[model samples]
Target: MLQLEIVTPEKKIYSGPVHDVYLPGSEGEMGVLEMHAALVTSLVPGELRYTVDGKTEALAVGTGFAEVTQERVLVLTDMAAGEAEIDEAATEAAIERAQQQLDQLDHDHDLEEVAMLEAALAKSFAQLKLKGKYKGLQ
Candidate 1:
């Protein structure tokens, strides 16, 4: 098994051994099994899955970073949410809200506002992708 730990500024979301893990990379989805080589890479907004004690659990994660060591996998991200924590309606609403802001913004938009909107869009996309893949599990 591979030790998996996920952390955010708010709290430590998870810490334990998992048989396998899949992360959404900026390039594409990546799967790591036991004894995988060490590496650190950026992740994009998408679904993250890991099998723990025979049961597979999925999470919606936003763009961030992941470090894979010989024995442990550490993920640091701005957002991480399980199925229960993810509200589809709320996420969809957030996408709409962000889009509205983008539309109303002036010709010369604030960089901070633009970044916030982009982040919101990524988060919402991750949720939708996770929900789509694991509907029965969710």
Candidate 2:
């Protein structure tokens, strides 16, 4: 078993032993299993999946970093939510709000604010997609 922990600024979302983990790495999707190489990688706003007790579970994760070791995988993300935790309507509203903010940006707009808004929009879309994909399975 490999210890898997997913943490956000507000709380520790998950902490347990998992059979395997699939991360949305910046380079691409990467899978981790027991005794995998030790490494650190940046994560993208996308779906993160893990298997435990022969059952697979998923979470929508925002941009962050992950540290992988032989026995553990620790993820520190801006946002992380299980499929059931995501509210489709709320996510849609957030996407709309972020788009509006992006649209309001001018030529002289701050790059930092633009980047943040874009990240928010991306995260919202990822959450919505995961929620929609798993809605029927739930």
Candidate 3:
């Protein structure tokens, strides 16, 4: 087993031992096991999954960084939500709002704002996916 800790700005979502962890790496998905190599990687807004005693748990996470070591994995993200914590209607509304803002944006819009909206869309979509709640809403 490997120690896994997931933290967001607001709280520590999880802290315990897990059989394995799958991170949404910038390059791609990465799985870390016990005795894994030590490294750091960037994460995107996506789903993160881990197995604990044969049961798998998943969370929707925002952009962050992960630190892996021989015995532990630590993830620090801006946002993290589990299926039970996600509100489908609210998430959909957020997606709609972000998309509307993105659509209204022009070439001269602030690049930072555009990126933030895009990240919001991605994070909301990821939450929907965690709950299997997407119904052609995007």
Candidate 4:
């Protein structure tokens, strides 16, 4: 088994031994199993899946960084939520709000602010997509 931990600034979301882990890396999606190579990589807003005890689980994660080693995987992200935890209505609302904010931006708007909003929009969309996939299973 490989130890896995997912953490955000507010709290530690998950910590346990997992059979495998899949992340949305900035470059692409990657999967990790026991004795995987040691490396650190940036993660994007997308679905994160893992297997434990022969069962698969998933989460929608915001942008962050992950550290992988032979024995452990540590993820530090801005946000992480299980399918059941995501509120589709709220997510849709957030997406609309972000889009509105982006539309309202002018030439003089702070570039950093625009980037942040874009990231937020992307994250919300990822959450919605993940939530939708498992909605019927719930």
Candidate 5:
């Protein structure tokens, strides 16, 4: 098993042993089993899945950094939401809000603001995807 820890600025979301984990990467979704090779990579906003005690759980995570060692996986991100934490209506609103901001952004808007908006869009989309996939199960 691999010790997986996911943390966000607001709290330490999850910490436990997992048999495997799947992350959304810039290139594509990737899976890591126990004793996998060490790696440090950037994570895109998407669904993160892990198996524990023969059951799998999923979370919606924002852009972050992931450190995968021989026995551990550490993920630090701005946002991480489990099924119970995700509110479909709120996520949809956020997506709409992000789109509105992006649409109103002027050509001369600050780069930082633009990036933040983009991140919000990504996070909201991720939540939407996860919710869609596990709606009935949840």
Candidate 6:
């Protein structure tokens, strides 16, 4: 078993043993299992999945970094939420708001603001995708 711990700025969402773990690496998706190599990598907004007790669970996570060791995996992210924690309507509204903000930016705009808005839009989209996937399971 591999000890997996996911923490956000607000709290620690999960800390337990898992059979396998998958993360959205900055370049692409990657999987980690017990005895895997030790490393650290940046994570993008996407779905993070893990298998525990023969059941696979998932969470939508925002920008962060992950530290993987032979026996433990630590995920430090800006945001992490399960399907039940994501509100579809609210996520949709957030996406719209972000889009509006991005659209308002003209030829000369603050790069940081644009990046922040894009990040927010991407995170909101990830949440919506996770919610949709869980709904399909119902």
Which model scores highest in lDDT?
A: 6
- For each candidate, give its TM-score against the true structure: 0.90, 0.96, 0.93, 0.96, 0.93, 0.97
Q: If the candidates were sorted by their lDDT against the true structure, best first, what order would they fall in?
A: 6, 4, 2, 3, 5, 1
Model 3 pairs whose backbones collide: none
The list of candidate 2 runs beyond 4 A from truth reads none
List per-candidate RMSD values in Å: 1.7, 1.1, 3.4, 1.0, 1.3, 0.9
- List per-prediction Cα lDDT, in the order shown: 0.89, 0.94, 0.92, 0.94, 0.89, 0.95
Model 3 stretches astray by more than 4 angstroms: 133-138
Q: TM-score of the candidate numbered 2?
A: 0.96
Error of 5 at 59 (Å): 0.2
Off by over 4 Å in 6: none
Question: Which stretches of candidate 4 lie above 4 Å from their native place?
Answer: 107-109
lDDT of 3: 0.92
Between candidates 3 and 6, the one scoring higher on lDDT is 6
lDDT, candidate 2, at 65: 98
Candidate 5 lDDT by residue in tens digits, 22-130: 9987788989888889998899999999999999999999999899998999999888998777899988988888888888887475678888899888898888888
lDDT of 3 by residue, 14-128 (tens): 9999999999999999999999999999999899999999988889999999999999999999999988889999999999999888888884757889988888998998898
- Model 1 ranges with Cα > 4 A deviation: 106-109, 136-138
Candidate 2 lDDT over 36-85, as tens digits, reads: 99999999999999999999999999999999999999999999998888
Q: Deviation in angstroms for 72 in model 3?
A: 0.3
Tell me how candidate 1 scores on lDDT: 0.89
